[model samples]
Target: MSILLILALVVAMGAVLYALVRGVIAMANGKDVSGEVQQGYMQKRVLYQGIAIVIVVLLLVVAKSNGS
Candidate 1:
């Protein structure tokens, strides 16, 4: 269970990082339509970060239950 939690956290963080970098690159491109692309990436980054947070909370709950 701990291993699974670690892997899930890693994957979620990686997704967030990927979206962030893509958004930055799109913004830097300075094209007229880049705003829409950046917005999409920003949304995806938020979603991934949210998922990571939820997973972390779940892991903590599981650990606490097991300890008791």
Candidate 2:
């Protein structure tokens, strides 16, 4: 179960990284057409970061509880 949560956290982190890179690329292109795509990637990046944070908190809580 802990391993599963760790895997999910990693996936979430990867998603955030992917979105960040894509958004940067879109911005670098400097085209109006890519604006919407960049926005979408930014939103996804935020969502994935949130997921990662939650996972980290859950892992901490679980570890703490188990340790006691």
Tell me, by lDDT, which candidate is best: 1
Model 1 scores what on Cα lDDT? 0.94
lDDT (Cα atoms) of all candidates against the true structure: 0.94, 0.93
**For candidate 2, lDDT tens digit of each residue in 1-68?**
78999999999999999999999999888885648989998999999999999999999998999999
Number of clashes in every candidate structure?
Answer: 0, 0
Native-to-model Cα distance after best TM-score fit, residue 8 in candidate 1, in Å: 0.4
Model 1, C-alpha of 58: deviation from truth (Å): 0.7
Error of 1 at 22 (Å): 0.5
Looking at candidate 2, the ten consecutive residues that score lowest on lDDT are 28-37
Clashes by residue pair, model 2? none
Candidate 1 on 1-68: residue-level lDDT in tens? 98899899999999999999999999999894738999999999999999999999999998999999
Q: Report lDDT (Cα) of residue 15, candidate 2.
A: 96
